[model samples]
Target: MDWPFSRRGLFQGAAVATGLAMASRGTAAPFDRLRQKNHPGWVIGHLTGAQAVAETLLAEGTGCVFGIPGAQENELWDELKARNVHYQLVTHEYSAACMADGYARATGTTGVLCVVPGPGVTNALTGLGEALLDSIPVVAIVGDVGNGEKARPFQVHSLNQVDLLKPVCKAVYSVCDVKQIPNAIRQAFQAATCGEPGPTAVVIPYNLLIEMADFRCPPLAEAGVPFDDAAFAQAVALLGDKRLRVGVYAGLGCMDFSGSLTAVAELLQAPVATSVSGKGAISDCHPLGVGWGYGPHASEVAEIAFAREKLHPHKSGIDVLLAVGVKFSEVSTGYYGNPRPKHVIHVDVNANNLGKAMPADVCVHADVGLFLGKLLTCGDTLRRPTDGHLLAKIRQAKADHEAKLKAIPAAKCGVDPLALVAALRRGLPEDAMLFTDVTASEHLAAESFRVTQPRTYFNPVDNQSMGWSIPAALGAQQAACGRTVAAMIGDGCFLMSAMELSTAAREGLPVKVFVLDDHAYHYMQMLQKAAYKRTTATELGRIDYRAFAQAVGVAYQEILVQDHLDAGIRSAVCHTGPVLVRVLTDYGDRKIRWIEAVRDRYAKELTPAQKARFASRIGYRTLSLKPEKSD
Candidate 1:
């Protein structure tokens, strides 16, 4: 074959083959990738900006990209297709951000989302904020208007996307040149995953994605967990004191180190309570594991387990709270409802967060896993004999918690709200990915629903973003390899993202969405009724759920009473396609412990004049209102 060509022609053909080989290196395996340490420069052929993003993403081990296509980044979509990079076209930009977040939560990797600027960026803000506050890693690739020589005064879909993304992202990189695309995207992933994980955005102008450049940027080393040796020593001094009884309060940062966390808890003979986002960090079945929030406003089990000596004579309450990777946020703390311990050892990756929420006697700037590992390495000095009495007390509190849930009588109006949580807990699989919305039941789920595995349960805990679970479940379904992905959506929150069920149907993502149909924003009503002695602007319009389900092309199931609870959940979870299960919910006479505790704490903070104003208003409402309760 070679003999047929001239010497010059043979050399030319070899050069052409070499160029093709270089260009095709986009999909190279990890071993074949160039390393920055090796100083490999421009060994690959020139590539378009879109190709740079696609190749960089593949190199970084990101499996799928989630977002809708628009005018600004059509070329990028084409490149993604060419590279066989997986991408999901969500119904809305908001869902794109949320789905990416869901993917991140479900898979424990950096999730990617792509969208055009302005409205696309604005629509995704809430979801990004949720990821930011909840410490989930998500990478967003956004398209901006033309810059450089292609700069134009009036461009479509133009806005300050970089600034809009900043508050919600750990870092926002705006790429101006095609050469910077790969580095920026890689850096974006790094930013999202490093230290305190959060959303990170890469804003690339549309003009640059089509430009050609020789991309030689290799993947950077993933950042290691930060540690402060001096602070760690200080923290250990507090934790190692045998006289001080300890309780472990974990957060999302401890999700990856659940085994270590559990080990630390057992070694100290301590009770473990998690933040809202840290629900599944320790198995709820663990003897020492109490539920979310060790405070008056949180799980009753946690509250009792952490109560002072007066409450439990057999064992004194937590004298020292070893709060690891958790911030005592306002919502989690119920207006700082967490009782001040005799000693507080607060440790987190970010130094700025230490002692901000509640006062920390010793603040340690260290990684959750690293710190837990160090504690275990301290040998017999850090170990405490297992206290059988403490275990018995925790068991009793847990029993009481379960008994309380079971004793709640079925609602006379429709389905009992508490029953809904109980049924899902009973019906769902052990490994199911459960995503809950910002409803009153979120607190209930945090309390009554048991989570046994890390990353298996999620809620928009910090930002309290409504309607988050629907699309999030669908996104989890995409990343989930046959595990059940379900969402418990509030009646009010459902209206915000109900349309996303159609996305599930379109993509054949079998997400079981349970709509808690109360026909009102009962969470809001509970607050208003307590404060003002009445409710206003809390009622929600009801939709014909069966018809809506059919219109959305998903299987429909209705749980009208207690009889339908388990059967309905079973049917929906077993369905091979998307299913919308509507539970006719009545939150009648059920108390939200969180709201009650939060209310009491908030009232305690008010001034005398402020208290009188509230009291007078309530008194006037009681006297002037009609005999019948008014909306």
Candidate 2:
């Protein structure tokens, strides 16, 4: 018997033979016969399992993949390089996943990542968990040991990769045969993106990746799920009560349907408040947008009262809350201190999420985009409440918040956090993508900075991880391509993933990294100071970030005063490649005092039972009634 011929040759030869037979009858051209023989669903050529996966990704219109090259996955990397697939080489596997998460959030598409098994898979779990919690669509391709060798004790870097990833991933697939690669990847993409999107893991055994096989790409799956029409009608009737003071609360899940949500809000003349993760879903500058001022730290009931007082002083608390794509997460609900509305119309893609945190009077199980589109069909019949007073209240509330920020005295230690935020807000482009790490800077940015576009602001939100911002910003910039991207990170956060700057430089990603150098874990310090009256082990001796940036082959700048802040930010934003701008910030106790003051104000608004519940939910000791002197 002749040795097995390559699949490419076999297919071409068969096509030519068939064409000759058909051409004798003058039925069709040889080219047409060849084309028909190699229809999209047919196997066109032979390729390694790795190449098949790469081709599948390209077919799905994946523009870039963030990952590290490793022994087990080197074949995949090689295939990606050969096919001109854009692979961003991250310094760590965790950052690779984070970059994918950021890319997915920025582009509203499935982000792809490839890494090796064992430690590589373990290292990426945190990022996967973040993606899972945030509902980001990402497909992670992990390379594992040879199919039969997975259970072998001596196999290097071999472990139960699927088991380790199952909890964090939406679904996990292990490819045992070479031919399973394409379908597995297609399914992984589908699983990652359909409904409440999340990360999915596809593990390809090392042997299968390098094995040659005839490959055919699978047809894309239909991803949309139908909505509950009965629930939609009920929601419409419930929300039609003109006596109800309605407020639309949106979250990250509403991002795809942001336009629809805005249109609905406009039709109802309702003010819209977003959870921190949902900051950009509606432009903060929109007339109805209330911004991210309703989190655990940000008082919700008080903010709503404030908004009502400013806009409709005669009206009572929000009678109807239209929560769209929101989980009513503890943080967003002020540790459940904020009372649930009398009537709630909750809409989400995932049925399980409806009424989990707060009871829903009418639950609509549908894609937010679809639900909002359907809701808009009845927009003409719905009454639009007078919003002139509401608009005035919104503007006044913003002005009052800014006034309070401006009233904080200048810091004696370093640059004031508020002042630094002002500089950043002024210097950075309005459309620039900004990421904030968990620190005093995050609070400052939350209260001070205004994000005018959707998906322009990225925060750890519920994850609250320290090192997420830099790598995430890098990935967002890669997804955005030419758009300016920046991450304002605390000193502690910078140390956690600063090595990624090297990856940024190597990839030629022009990401501006701003280190908010307060010389300590300021957020924790504030907590300690307020709860214990002193801080311990929160101090971080200043690192010469300029020298560190130089070592990593990135341009660096240090801003010590307000005057240099704007120019420094401008320089970094305008730099051709990665640049670090370290702003030495003050460790003022004012932030701590502000936290205490806000809590006190919110406490006064809560009932005894609500206060106890809040305390229990936060799992912290009762704060001392004695007020500390303001610095």
Candidate 3:
């Protein structure tokens, strides 16, 4: 069957067509020899299905696989070891998938994994779901029961694996025949790396993994769909409007073309803001980068900076928004509380996403890299005034925002979350990659941490899943090789995947783990207090992280006060091996109140009806007030 954007035709032509083109040269003899019917390269090689899968992945330039070995898929592990491919062993199947997802996000490559069926596949669903939601490329190879054992009543780890993964994966392929191994592997990678990239699954029966086969590898094709040129021209026209003050909102899709993205912003003299998932697409320190903010729930500093820079259309100045690679999802758009530009030009690889959340005056269905490249080429002719005054205003606003964030009062009880984030930012290298879980620290990091490179900061933004940062950091560190990697996680999030600490020790991966020990699910606890005046099951009793670290064979440190934060963070950063630094932080009520204050200040601009609706939506009814009232 033919597939969309299939590269089969290119593969078929590469060997022969290139040979004929080279025939006029003296080097054609080697090509002629290769064309012989008895050529050795064309011969059917005897390889087990597992070996074939490994070979295919190697050919695709895969450097490692994050997975767990299971009874049914032990042969695959053996073959991977024999082939000298690195297998990052994880304790849980879910962690394996998350590791792969994190690896893919950091490296911009397809992350591969292996797991057994039944609970193995089920356990991987959350990680795959996170990948799906975040548009990350990953291929999960699952092991199923043998072909002849279909529907056996008591077969261990036996279930329909394809059905289980189909909902979360981009595509699911169940290989029943050994000969289909090569093609199936190719298809899985293609699906995972193609447009709207996401996780794909390939379920091969355990018996086939051990069976020998004469595998004929097919040529793989690069996948991308052509975009509409008319829409591109229309977008250019809209952006060229001198009357509109343009602002660029970037998302994950624009990561590949960050240079061109920044170039376009520079040409239009527009400030660039990013979605949380899109942080580091451009250096946050760049002159045109106004810092990360697209939604109302953005970092307090980002929100304040955005408002001061006049990037928010409703607040004051910007008339047009160039949204690239953004989904305009609830998190990114703050449930649509963020105002839409009077004129919007939306660009996305997925056509369906163009107007799915917010209407666009012009929609371009194209790869962000290509689209931005084209836009840059035409940008000179459409250059704007450069707005020196506006640029200065933005710079000043950024300084003011930083000053305000630093001035936030520390909690009376424990280390301030903001102070902890600041210390971490100072301690780590500029290029160090950071992974964050859904916690109060995440919000603080969003406002304080400055990501200077693409793929340097990763968060479970859309999924908001706990226990993601630790394993994800492991995968990212593996992909980064010698580069430093760190995870800022809450105590609650740390415990969810705490077992993976052993995996880091075993692999000898030096990932600095900073646990914000707040003794509760701080984010939800704040919400509970705001909405219901009480907290529940969210609190997690204090953990002895030093004891836990010793048991897991990792380095450990703890900081209870502000004075030792910098030194503690620096020591962890300089550690050559995995280290867990637990910071006993306060309840973060101060930060929560600061955010509420910002929200209240901003809500004054909205009409009373709009204010009421927004308050209800965000569960800020208690904090809501009459339009005329002062704090």
Candidate 4:
């Protein structure tokens, strides 16, 4: 579609359609004229406290505030509910933050979240970090005690709130002046969504929310424009080198700039891949499209295939890596094992991450979607796809992985990871939104499943936090009305937010949760098995997941093998309410020896500096393990 806010169309429409007809005879400031002629007797409401801030927040399009409501935030919650803004009561503050983060990631807007001061805020740090790293805009409105003895005691109880978040947020402001609430809301929105979007925090005093006052919202024009074009153009040229066999990697940012990415990719015809977080950024079936590669598991295959000749359809081979709206974390580049063919071009809204790990050959700091639009104009030409011979090699490399997946055998209690993923892929409804929690199961699903659309596949990749899938799916299901939301989580991930099933049941959200019951942190267990040659605390006693779901008043069933998966999913979907399908699987011995050999060959003999660099890579911490080997 047309750019959401086309400057030319906006300028033309304003000038031609309403310029003369709406113009005043004499020159006067628009705000001044509005305050006098059109807005006569329009008294500006003075919000005295926190409840008033909630009222103003409600006025500004926030439908719900996700949080673990407590004594400190009760007044604000009461007022928010009174204003008809729903409260997404969650099990933990982090899960609540994650729910909002997931919603914002999918919707490209500031997700509103509320939390009590101290413990509550601290609990949400993980989610906040995830949102920051992924460039997902979310507004964290925390209720802090006012400047008094209680505030000092609060400080002692809490890690310095703003200090704790400084590294992970766009900005943090304490709301003191009652009148500043509206501006604070606007600033929080701007901070969360501006160039290199991320979460922002606005601390409001706990006692102030109950204070009475009138609230007035600022006009839309006064909300400040997002980005500047001149600055954006400079950023676009950073990756505009013609000699560079540019591999355009996109993420969630491309979903917002859909046409811009298509325009730019069509012009360059470069091989494109989407990060898992940006799954729907481009059509996965397209010739130019390469699948998600942001972790060691797949990155090893991608690195080898990309480095060798004629791997992808665009065989030109990535002489220059141009990542747009994509976070180039260590995982994004295979723990830095994926050697750059030439220059690496990194474009993002966050300046902090521009050159953090895999420093870009050319770093362009600007709004991802905006810069993408400008890049389309800057590079306008349809070029041929790169080296053709490489395509066959990539196919062979991927086929090798597929063969390994097929060899995995099912265990008595725990199912094969590949079989579980295949079952979910085939069993779920066509339009279902699939969400994978952090575990070996997610890696299995990521490798085997094909994501047809972007937002339909959800995972907290930037932070890779555990326990995010179920709550995130709940939030997404609320956003996707009648459509199905299938959350594939591990046993641990389910425990983290399983209690929130009460909230799901209360809200009547129709989401199907497929709990991959491995009975431990499978990812960690895999690593331990690979490195330490055994397992310890990684294992846990079995709990009846069916009883747990029934206790929460939702439907539940057990699926022990691939044959039973389809029926279990169909039953869950037919229930018209929340359903939890627990799929029991063994830690079946299915080792990915090929991957281990690849990494061991290059990584085992690395120099100290190279090793240190590798350690600092994203997702590298978990590189000690390889998949189990059935053969």
Candidate 5:
């Protein structure tokens, strides 16, 4: 046993030497020698295990990471900080996921989120579901217990975390080996941004994160494939067929696509209809921009009908519909059946969406901006609205629709949802963001508010899930500091996520929640009355919302009249932290126009008297706002 110069000593010496070699610059280890150059981007790294994962994130150009680094995954946090990457500590895991989604929605790039186990995964589920439905690109790197050693049953740190997330994620990767982390991250990114676009999950075990690194992965940034040029040419050629009446349907994807949106409008002299998400994608005042995506009132109906005729197939007054980046959904399209237009040409980044149900005669799985730009530059057959009579018909349709939307008179105790939305729009800044939940409250907001900027309106309309408004607004507030963030939730949706206001308060995020207190889901009531002709399970029990707000230590307000609306909004905006404004409403009886429109459109043969009665009840009326007390 003299000096014990054994194999163990030699192994220890080699480990130290390897560590030193890794620390030295320009020293190529076996893993480094095997690293692939010219793979995707100029940025490359030789990393393995948890360090490799961190290096992969850096390679992907992720400037910021929104998450709380828990005890189990502090190593990842340390590595991120070491690389000078910014980390935002969101109030909760759900907020972290939503914050990333909002960032991606605003920036048009994939966002990154990190979370711990069990509850963390559950908390993030809602936002991830929303991203999946909306075709947003987001990546969630969740931490798990490495090596699967659990002292107790159902422990949070189990390796089965990837399996837990598989149902909701676009793709799930359980990295078991230290060397596989880099490629796993790259695949996660690809799954998120490629094809239909959605969220992907990469689960890293805590034990694995601490393992020694063998290599680093380089960033996989590269120019996306060129837009389908042949499709562009075909679209241009189809538009040139003067035999067809071509109309352009625009979506949010076209907001910054000045070249393409403008060129297509000018070339085809076709009016443009935008989805709610596409509000302001094209200038509302633009001559070619007809109106919004679907009909909420007469204005929308008239605009859509006018647009349909101009783009109908067979060039028979309306022959072709060039829909761009519009994810035609039920609410956006008034729940009426989406009639396939003649020669339907759909161009969207999500290829899976192009031929969905309503088959597209010309499906261009390309970016709207890129494809439109090329078509505008190469195609020369598009023209202005040369037919004066046709333009007038379109104008008349819009005017009639607006008049219908204006007809619903508000009862003495009821508030006009549209007017409230208009007030919010008027008082808010151009760049201010508004978050809203599904239900009648959102419908009114969409109908009345006119957004002209990106990230100006944030509605969780994708999954059509309730209780998303409050947390989503908190996420937005965290992501966009110093900007006004407000969530407009119905009495029903408000109650679901209202408890999270405590988190908002603790985080010092100044998010205002406006509760439309109508004592029920008014939209459901309206639908029941129209369809089933009865109200059931739509009423809500009364509670002191102001008291609830006060208990949460948030500024509280209860407004019952139009005169108090502006003051309340201004006061909330000036508050330092969270505020809850309960605007008592009686929209319970207000009629939803889309439902009425559908009824009238599909009414069967009727007698002279029946026809007269239907026509009289078909028109819209404005609901007048009045002062009232909470009885």
Candidate 6:
């Protein structure tokens, strides 16, 4: 029999995975490996495709797989469990994708999600889009309908999955033969983690999953960050200017290099700011850390610290902005209001993102880790004596900001959103994983939340996918056992993903999900009331969340008054299983500064006629409302 394994391919793939490592991780040696080539990488095995799939996943260091198995993928799902590879069954396909995303973000490793074809692919698209835009590494293993020699048209759950996924995935691979399954899956992992990471899809026909074939799947080396020597030379030369007032704007790309980032910041004597997704890349407690964003749309502390006039008598706010690993997305930049300083040194792993948001004096296409690492090599040239004045300004701004945050209290009706967020910040573990959804409180949390480590805080900023936090928290909890994981979800967002809470309860993931119960889509209400002078269709049904929690087989806690805040958090944290915590929230007369800044920038872009129309509508609506008849 002619061997189906390729000799050329075996030599080309992998640094290699140790058998001892696989054993330690509880994965049994591959199901049926009858013969192996001279090279250990090539495991020529007479096994079903499902066995091949499970073996590859274990080798790739995937701790858990999140998805709902269906008819098309049942065989593969069974194989995964047979090998002792942990798999969590989610309630919805969308939640599966979100969970995978959460796992990837929290653990800084690739997340895997498996689903059947057609509806499964469609249902998971939104989560994939979120992952893609947020630069998350997720591998979506989708099972396609049979396309063997006798393949027929119009098969059940059969659609052009590859085309459907292309919009949301970084790359998509369609496997034809059973022998190709291992390489296809391995390549998916490589694609998912390479450079600017995002979701990658590997489509395997269900027929192939059950077919027996000889396999030669050798895992490939994980992708490494790019380093351009000449670009580093150019960047170093720019930083060598001792007279330049430098400021650092870091992003998610700088996550793995936080230590290097901190070193470079101290050397440059620069204040550091981050994008929303980039929060926690530097410890917010760090003296040099000014908080997220560095313009009018940013934190007041960041705005003040970056203001040249505030720090110096005559110099500009930031003479040179060292922006790394962050894109100026509309949400993060507040309609691109983030500063475009005189000399912008924008560096990123993804070349496409560089120089597109803000014009750059020097654009460096390199991984943030590699770039920061190179900077440390010539630390002396970039080193500057610490400026007492700059440090004093940042310290004062932070102190005042903290004082302001501490002084705010909940309004009469319910807990103030920021007050709740601040309480959680104080009560939760310093190293806890916090995920926030798209809501008014998200902005409030961004302003007041204190994060001490990289990848500790996450938000659906660019995608603005409501209800993302619930599943995301559970997903992260699955990967991060023993660490606390929490989600601050709005009442409206809670409704969108309320079913997913049951998945956590079933899987026993201890994720404290807090529902900011305002009895309405208050985030939308705020936006609409400002634009239309009256809210429409923003109200949500008042839910008896305690009862809902009982139905879902989880512990329930509610923080109605300000007095119960600490006790409520403690109860949830101490609970053994998943807990749903509800905080009655009031956004009355509270301001989300990010929203205000975005609205202001948007208003400036409105034509005079457009403004007049809005004004006319507001006037008409205000005049049309009749006074209530008092008895």
- Sort by lDDT, best first: what order? 1, 6, 3, 2, 5, 4
lDDT of 3 at 221: 56
TM-score of each: 0.93, 0.87, 0.86, 0.80, 0.79, 0.92
Residues 571-630 of candidate 2: C-alpha lDDT, one tens digit per residue: 888888899988888866555323554556566889999877766644443364654332
Deviation in angstroms for 132 in model 2?
A: 0.8
lDDT for model 3 comes to: 0.80
Overlapping backbone residue pairs in candidate 5 total 30
Q: For residues 12-115, write the lDDT of model 1, one tens digit per residue.
A: 99999987875665344354454433544222346778878887787778788999888899989988998889998888899999999999999889889999
The true-versus-predicted C-alpha distance at residue 497 of model 4, in Å, is: 2.2
Shift in Å, residue 120, candidate 1:
0.8
Cα lDDT listed for each candidate: 0.87, 0.78, 0.80, 0.68, 0.70, 0.86
Model 3 clashing residue pairs (backbone): none
The runs of at least 3 residues in candidate 4 whose Cα sits more than 4 Å from the true structure, single-residue gaps closed, are 1-48, 148-161, 164-168, 213-244, 294-296, 299-305, 310-316, 378-382, 385-414, 592-631
Worst 10 residues of 3 by lDDT: 22-31
Off by over 4 Å in 1: 1-43, 311-314, 625-631
- The deviation in Å at residue 53 for candidate 2 is 1.4
TM-score of 3: 0.86
**Span of ten consecutive residues with least summed lDDT in model 2:** 299-308
* Arranged by TM-score, best first: 1, 6, 2, 3, 4, 5
Local error of candidate 3 at residue 582 (angstroms) = 0.8
Candidates 4 and 5 compared: the better one by lDDT is: 5
Worst 10 residues of 4 by lDDT: 21-30
Of models 2 and 6, which has the larger TM-score? 6
Best by lDDT: 1
Relative to the unseen true structure, what is the C-alpha lDDT of residue 294 in candidate 3, on a scale of 0 to 100? 45
